[model samples]
Target: MTSAAPVATESGVPLRKPRIGLLGIMQALYDHMIPGITERQSGYAREIADRLADVADWTVGRPVKDRTDAEEVMREFVNADLDGVMVVLLTYGPAMRVARLFNENRLPVLLANIQPEPQVTAAWDMADMTYNQGIHGAQDTANAMVRADRSFEVITDDWRAPEFAERVDRWARSARAITAWKSLKVGIFGYAMNDMGDIRVDENALLRALGPEISFVAPGDLYRGSLEVPGAEVDALIAWENARFEVDPDLTAAEREDHARMQLAIEKILVERGYRAYSTHFDAIGEDGRFRRLPLAAASSLMAKGYGYGAEGDALAAAMVYAGHQLIGEGHFTEMYAMDFPSDSILMSHMGEGNWRVARDDEPVRLIHRELGIGRLEAPPTFLFRYRPGPATLACLVSLGGERFRLVVAEGEVLDAAPLPQLEMPYGQFRPDSGVRACMDGWLAAGGPHHQVLNVGRHAEDWRVFCRSSGIEFVQV
Candidate 1:
């Protein structure tokens, strides 16, 4: 049978734009006391929404003046299925009028403490007080939210400030990440590595805390699928790989074809089943000699194409890497293997699996053969390269038992390094902003797992915001 189109050709994860609902709040008494106060303040809300137009998918609601107006507007926001709500206090509104609605709805809230005027000056008059004096209202609402045990973020600044827009954009991105997390589905082939305690997680707890659906696949199914992959597709994949990466001359034609068939089969399963992330146990795949070679290259290629993959059936790491991809566009699956005390750098690598897209520009990725001493298996073709030297973030999601997960993150730099031809795996040397000793101490103290996702750039604050929105604990070292 003819095979389906290759899923590996897709370049990056397609993220849906974050949907945000903007609502303005004001006291009902203002309508009678100041004839045009509500209408004028509503104009300020529209201006702020317009400024944030490019940042998110905005659904602007009419200014809410009393319980009646608040209920109606809140209904609109709910109907819009927003990722979050930006509550703009247009004027001095009573907290009781809208605080309960926020508490009950439980949507991630951004209390916009922005004012129309940047500063009070000689030109400031009663009109400025009527329109720009919304900070006190924000304070009142925040106090009520705290008493009611609700989570929120308060952004205080003049709406016109560049920083204000940047902060809003960050919040919108975090909201989008949270939305993606809620809809994530991860697949696992075979069980986790035998007696691997650190990577073990309680699936029920994981689902409750992180909102990912886990689907387990039998190893036999993968073996059968690999056999069914069309020879034409396998040849095409081998040609594509040869063009992109440096194929070792020692790799035989049969070896390349077998690896290509396995890779195609894995990609087909993931794409057809709508799995955003996946994991496989090496020992299990090697068991019974169903797979002559482990599919390490398959994992590497999938990761390069923006599909999350964790070696040794690490489902949590798989999901976390996917989340990192959604937030930062690229993420690499890795673990700290050794520490260089003299250089203050930690050696990071995995068992012949990593996103080759993160390789240094100066070096070409090499697809080489690897030997697995496990269960009647031969050497498989996998990638070997040096990670890009730049600022990066190392992050992991660890379960703190039932319904509790903490995101441990560290901002670091991947030091300039040459590929270790002797190691025969994708590797990098990372120096944390905090010294190696301190970073290690802090990471261990925060219950960090060995398997972590690395992404380019410093994203601790983005993760902090994401954790707050999703109710996960954030620990940055």
Candidate 2:
């Protein structure tokens, strides 16, 4: 079972800043990063502390007691065990010296702080100077860290800014999120079906790049699980068929009861396997001795609608399934399709788990049949509405050019329209996107090699950060 618990890094989730060491330089004010003479300020400091906790499970340590000696802090930051560090400054020792130490350690840093007091023998100006000290501490930390030649970000605002605070929280959360998904596992079922060019995915590259582990799934396991469906659980299939086929009448009791079994079996397989997404070839030709029990129309329909069933069981398609689960928070499964038509809209859907992403304004998908051994059982299917234009990203988990590369990355969009005709499945169903033909053509022309996973999402400036963390290539299309 391919499971997509954590969203893929490249898709809207940013990669974590790896591991970091947090250092709060508060020796100037009672050994606290945020020094406070009043309770309100102290409470603000606590909020900042809570934010750190929200961001990462970090190691907090003392800074240089001697304003002139920050070598120890720098050493700890640069120590191989840590990835980066956050510093809460309450003092402004020699900025240059502190800066040099950080440069040597070369770890990422974040400047965090609240107000601090200043040295005041003159009562007339003491309180004001002290308040200024806290503000300066945060700034000095930022300046020193940046001057030291390390990449650093800053967050000085206190709890008053709840929304912005959450943004900072997301940064720390991003770190944990990347790590959590990096060590995650996804299952891949069956082998790639024919005609879907090699996506050339390199597992090592993926680990080096994305951090997801691909587990192999057997056809027998999937098939065996299908037999375990219970007698109850008819809601899913009935709802699907009814919503899918826009006919005035609904499905009969017998059809609903029967389809329910298949849906139940499908869900059970996912549950038992701990899979977030998967692709498998249910070809009946016995090419690999795998037999076809029930008409895949039912299973395929179930899988495409939000379920993850890729035709040919190709890796690239599996990656697509993975993307749907991660980015869309669901999985979409299907075979490579050709498109050449001019329509303002189209659908991107299947009859399974990931199908929910289809434009609700378009059409719904319906399942049809074909010979299993030959590959690709075709029938017109409706998915929500037309294609979403503008910036989009396409990926693929493929093997070719002597290597298997999982997606890397390509940016594109739904063009004017795809070039294809209305499908001919008995029930009124239509293909999703019309620009696929052009997409494939452009990909082949650009030396994309073969099969790839496709998805659409809003782009951001930090996209590269997303790629680096995910372990896939962020190639320009």
Candidate 3:
């Protein structure tokens, strides 16, 4: 069954429509007698597909007429560049042979085994009423894929049960959700820091599994744009704000003016480049008359409002994008610190950017500051904070969890744990943020790999979908 459209009612986040693929349901009658019913499992399989059609956009049934059927299905999946595919096991015929066909194409396949609810009086009388037909069919399909070293997402909920429709619908929706990830695109600005150089990660590795793409930019480009701000640009900034969130009363006059200018610059870049997501530098200011802010707060705010951002991007941004896509929510930024590190769980959270659409709205959020004396910003120590607004899948662009490239994907919640208490410690507070604690828990418990990235809204899964399309590992949490 296909899932219902994701409604905002489930959360403040909007529902994303997934472009999904459907595998013909087949009745594997290798050992069981063919039902007196006509045409094996063809009609039943189509009905199952019809049920999903009501909720999603899909093309169903690659009837295994021959090896060509598998090839045709694979071709369609690739050409359509679909997000996810649902394979309903009706029979273990040539239909089963096609499971790996799409898997190799990196399409996440959902192994669905659903039987019609309410067995008919004739179902059993027919001498071939096989309730386990659907169940066993899927198991065998999974077996075939596994034999070929393939992995798949399976939904074995009883469709004949009272809540069958709801369960099937939700899975269908989730499958679609995963599909959305396949089309994710991420934007990158600024180069990796030569210092703290250890944070580099392998973006291609993530691209191999995730579907997001990086848009390269120079630090000076943003700085140049900031200095060259114009009146028309300012107006465009307001328009972006309106699209992002409702402007609120809490914003100070100074905040509004600054926001007005910053928003214009960002909007110019995003609109000009056709980017829906981004990751950028936090300390790329200029010397003398020119200066720039890393736009950390801005990144946080936009991501929370449904856009995605990876700070220092590289690989970490991509990882967070994947986690956000998987978790179906925003991913916050996080870092590793021994004392604050979770023996168990930890999540990350941050108040959004001062100029971001979400931040302009001033939704209730905790406010934290940089640890005194940790490191001084060359610019004024103002509200230019680098925070991940929600729990996320942490990642890096460097390799070996170090300088080359690595992505962090996490799943967790926000916590109100107090910030580090006064003590003889490192310059910056060496403790974890309350939000980070919540996220850490999610990462450890969910077994979502840890590190850090910017995942703040419902689109992260789309980022994961992008990862799959791009051939990056979408580690589960």
> In lDDT terms, which candidate is top?
1
Per-residue CA lDDT of model 1 for 125-234, tens digit only, reads 77678777788999888998888877687798878888888888888888776766777788888888988888888887777766787888888878888889988788
Task: Give the Cα lDDT of each candidate.
Answer: 0.84, 0.44, 0.47
lDDT of 3: 0.47
> What C-alpha lDDT, on a 0 to 100 scale, does residue 386 get in candidate 2?
37
Off by over 4 Å in 1: 1-5, 14-16, 67-75, 374-376
Writing each residue's lDDT as its tens digit, candidate 2 over 175-294 gives 333444454455555555556445435666555544555667665664554445433334544554565555323334544444354345545555566654455444522343533333
**Most TM-score-accurate candidate:** 1
Per-model RMSD to reference: 2.2, 9.0, 8.3
> lDDT per residue, candidate 3, 1-477, as tens digits?
111111111133454555667766443344345543225455666666566565556766555434567668767876886766777655444435555574465666666666554445654643444533556656666777777665565555654454645444554555554454445556666554456554454555444444445557665566555656765544554455445444444444444445455544564566567565666545333222244223444554455445555544444444344445344444444444443345243323322232122221223232222233211232211233223234433443334432222233444433334434332111112222334555456445443433354433333344443334333454433
Off by over 4 Å in 3: 1-13, 25-43, 49-55, 94-103, 117-127, 130-132, 160-185, 195-198, 227-258, 286-289, 322-327, 334-477
